[model samples]
Target chain A: MNVRKQFRAGSEFRIADHHPGDKPLSSGDKPADQLRVSGLAEQIAAFQDIFYAEHRRKLLVVLQGMDTSGKDGTVRGVFGRLDPLGVRSVAFKAPSTDEREHDFLWRVHEQVPAMGQLVIFNRSHYEDVLVPVVHGDINEPECERRYRHIREFERMLCETGTVLVKFFLHISRDEQKRRLEARLQEGDKHWKVDLNDLKERRYWDAYQERYERAIRETDTDPAPWYVIPADSKTHRNLAIASVMIDVLQDMKLSYPPPNPEYFKIKVE
Target chain B: MNVRKQFRAGSEFRIADHHPGDKPLSSGDKPADQLRVSGLAEQIAAFQDIFYAEHRRKLLVVLQGMDTSGKDGTVRGVFGRLDPLGVRSVAFKAPSTDEREHDFLWRVHEQVPAMGQLVIFNRSHYEDVLVPVVHGDINEPECERRYRHIREFERMLCETGTVLVKFFLHISRDEQKRRLEARLQEGDKHWKVDLNDLKERRYWDAYQERYERAIRETDTDPAPWYVIPADSKTHRNLAIASVMIDVLQDMKLSYPPPNPEYFKIKVE
Candidate 1:
């Protein structure tokens, strides 16, 4: 289904479909999704090995979302089964004084994964558009130029063998509020919730406006964005996991043939 | 056992002792010390969970080694078991044009792990000391200044709650030659071994001398270095896994309990 087509129909952009998988909301007992999860996990792992062995292609995954939209949780739940060696995740936060002194993409460009590796941008280059657009850090003319540069940058990545997959975890304001409060009430979790988060909450409407526009403008062929419904964390995990599997399977990777002369190594 | 104290005694630097109660080089299907491996694996997994849950103490794992020293294999074997969401790996290459324009540490500092996460520097801050010190990128007086700055920077990291674990994957030159040849003979493995690797191989002796001095000088009380033998990949994984478990377990942590009482307001 064309998820983005549906998203453009109205001003209020949100996730419409929830996953039909049987992953239960409560953590008590999960009835064997391991077979499904493990199958996909093994496939992803195998694909990663081929990418490394062949040293041919690159892949990038960009995950952008509001707080409690399951960026971290979805990553944990989906890629949990793969080997960490070939996979790299870069989480971008507020720019440091030194970073702010340079171009926005300077810090990000440094973290892009090497050839034959998968790079995940957690709240990635999109921030150049979203955060600055909402906070009015740059004028409209400058914002337009920055957005153009981002598109070209990603296009260059795609040309250089990067198969980019971008996901935007869509959550409602109400769901976010409930999750934020939960973080505050939990024993050790209070540390995760900052009072500054409340300030960001106030800018929700402005951020949403900026997000939708950026999605509309930058959702090109090589780097399309998928908006996943993340209200129910379980459903969100299963859906994203399925999407990730579909991408790797499409890549048509296989484990390199086991060397027939492997026994030649005399273990001393 | 006081591993650091043992490290101080030059004679105790034997690679075999890392296996402790087992024949480390054995090729049996069953690990030489099954009980120890299982116990250590479980402890490592649990401690990583607490470290992940804490959402406060950031971790920096610096992996430095000689050519064919099992750096890639160790990351794959040990961290392969970690929850991928909570970890990020950054591999440092020879500095680019823009990177060289700045101080050596400038590029590395940008990649430091954020709060509530684990960041592995496949080669780290010590590169400023080791590479330049060996390659003549700087003079003795300037190199000494960098050595002090690195110590101070690491001390700062610890003060700011970033737990640092530095591992030196130690392997004999003969073993390295064997592994490199293995890569060449294997069907798809040849891509990882480039001509530059052979060029770099010529400097092994100089690299080792520099490493010996750096380890002795910078191995501090707060961030002591662990020199794991890479002759056997299994032993390297097992030893590093055990040390990581010890560190994370020392930092007590708990899950962020959900607020069952919060009512979810439906936005219609």
Candidate 2:
């Protein structure tokens, strides 16, 4: 199956349309699927080396999901093998005092990848649209305005040679409850367990509706969103890796040609 | 020898006191020195992985030098082996309109490395002081004020879990002339040969004097500056890699302990 086409968010995309438990990218054997993820991750790392050497194009991967939806795990599994020098994972928390002084996109714009870079945003400007809309901090018209701003901002990044990939890790409500319970039960994970996550869980349906609207309104050819079925961690990783590999392969990345003149001249 | 102590800028530090051609770190064998640099680079990469996992400390490597002093080359040689995910090289060119609207350090402060990140500044806030002083755009008092600001800014970073290592790649005027000439002669290098560099070369002595004053005024215990002899590319690489390895070793970086509870829990 063409995983990219299968997961690509369209205008008609509904958060409920896709089953979170589906394992479209997985083979029948679980261990084999896990092995496939590892192999693809290594290949992505190799491609990243050339991508850094080429030093021409930029790639930005935006990951947005509900809490306990495996954003961090996806980073560790899919992108962890890549060299830290060229790839950066920026996790956005709530805006600080200084961040609130500027427009919402101010901090986000400052962290975009430069030439020969691939940066993954653990959460992104999408949060600005979702949280506010769900809380009624911004009305529907204001939320729509912010979506327009995001589309324009992304289009600008694309025009300036950035390849954008947005992923929404889709997890079922029951899966979230299980993950949250695991956080509570595990002593080591107690540190990561926030009462706020449970509080946020109360706004589940509102968040889902906001996410669907945000993804639908801003989904463009230049920066398409991918909704990954994330209940199965292994399948989520495999599917995201597959989509990234396809995107990078289509980029036709190659290192800048060796300088012929530079070869002849010896460093004195 | 304490490599860090040997290169640390002092109150009496003068740019002319250090010879750009001196290879204090070299062992007299040229090829062997190059090999040593490669080895050090690998060791530093390994330390970086642990440092990243530790996620406690921050490292800031600031590169400052005149034109053709090998700032870019130093990044490629000493920092190239690092994983791109943990390391970032931010090249600060002339300020844009938006940047000019803010205080000089505004754009800079926004780019400081987060926890577990190592950031290299190609040309940093130092530029704010240097170019203005050299061109008489800012008077001596203004320059001194900017130096005070830098000292405080760096101190703030140091206090906040950041280990600062600033390098001034010291290359002689004659060596710079040779490099510029080679850039002009080589077809492959023509793209990198900026005409502005030639124009800036006219203010060579002024720039050197300003750099000396900047280094002397800002050098402190927490954030020390290293004067690197950069005439010999291989020696320059070796000296820098050695300094960096020494600094990172001093940091005593280690991964966060494995979570015992996490170890026991199997993913369902």
Candidate 3:
């Protein structure tokens, strides 16, 4: 079952073509599917140990989504099983004043995976395309150029050894309303609710348009995007976990062969 | 039971006075003790949500030890439950050329936790006092100066609202020999067997002495040190998790009160 191929974003990808309510990956039994996700997480951990030992290949997982989408939840559920010492999950927020001085990629480039590392960008360089474009900060010409730069930058990363897995957690407008309203009503979750998220909701369709265009333009073979059906949190984790395991298994990860010299050495 | 105070390193502290094999924090049943660690890990996770919601306190956990003292395992065990988005565990390896150009603390200072974060230093600035000092890179007077700087730096961090929990994972020389022998013999573990770790083993006594002196010198109340007995891997995790929960509890963590204005806002 080529799970990644089924969901991979292509140049012709459209947000409307996908339904947030769909759960192609689910078994229809919610609890059972969640258990399967936990099982997949364990498999990922096993491979992660061997992957770290291989120490030659790099992996970068990019998660892009609208406000209230489960980007943070995906990281916590799937990648959380990997050794914290090895898996670095970086959540990119609004750029700091210092970061604003540099090109968008400058700060992002500083955080890419090195050899034997697995890095997760909670919200990534894709935000440059999503947020600014929705706000009309960049003209269409500039947006296209940024897309080209992204394509070239990602291509370079893939050519250099990074295996990129990008995801757009797709959720519907009504789901966002339910989530936002819940946050407003729930005190414990208020910290997570940036008031700006509600203000930004006014441009939901615009953001969706920008997201669809960005995904279409920058979608490449080496670094393709996966539009995950994220309306159901369990299904989202299940699908993303399935995709992650698929990618890692594709890498054919293994431990390095033992060295003869190491056996000859004595610890004393 | 003031677990931290019982294990705290003070000016009179000496590694010779402690036994790495001790399991004071354990239940004496390996399975039960391991289960307790898991339970404590869950508790830490629960507290973590409220702590993140509180969004005002910072936690910096520094883990330092000899090779195979279980710093990595402790991370995988205790801190693994933390949301990757909220917790960052930094494993400081040998400095790069660019890093060496700056002062020792430069790289470390840049990685400290911000409010609402928990940052773990797998190995940290203390390496400067341990490795370099063990190799005769600095004299006694210079070493004392570094200790003073460390104390002052930690004081400032605590004063600025960062709570520090530093651990010295104490493993016996014999245990390390056994672990190293196993690593050398196992094909799967070879990747983690850095030849430099073997070479440094020759300076075991010297490194221990420096660790003691450094811990004693800088073990101020603002940033006290807890000497964790790590020969028993389960006990090491159990103790660290216990201390972590203790510290987080002391903070009196709670979700911020519901904003009255938030109740009035309509998501649609």
Output per-candidate TM-scores for chain A, rounded to 2 decimals: 0.83, 0.98, 0.98
Candidate lDDT values, in order: 0.69, 0.88, 0.87
Model 1, A136-177: lDDT tens digits are 877788777676666765665565467888887778888889
Q: What is the Å distance of residue A73 in model 3 from its true position?
A: 50
Q: What total of clashing residue pairs does each candidate reach?
A: 0, 10, 0
Candidate 3 docks at the CAPRI level of incorrect
Worst 10 residues of 3 chain B by lDDT: B97-106
- Return the clash pairs for model 2, or none: A83-B84, A83-B85, A84-B83, A84-B84, A84-B85, A84-B86, A85-B83, A85-B84, A85-B85, A86-B84
**Chain B, TM-score, each prediction?**
0.84, 0.98, 0.98
lDDT of 3 by residue, A97-210 (tens): 655533466567677777788999999888988888888887788788678667766765675578999999999999999999999899999998898998999999899999
TM-score of each: 0.47, 0.53, 0.52
The residue pairs found clashing in candidate 3 are none
Q: Rate residue A143 of model 1 by lDDT.
A: 76
Most accurate candidate by DockQ: 2
Candidate 3 C-alpha lDDT tens digits along B62-117: 99999999999999999898888778999999999645543466578778777788
Each prediction's interface RMSD?
12.8, 12.2, 13.9
Give the fraction of reference interface contacts each candidate recovers.
0.00, 0.03, 0.00
Winner by TM-score between candidate 3 and candidate 2 = 2
The list of candidate 1 runs beyond 4 A from truth reads A1-268, B2-42, B256-268
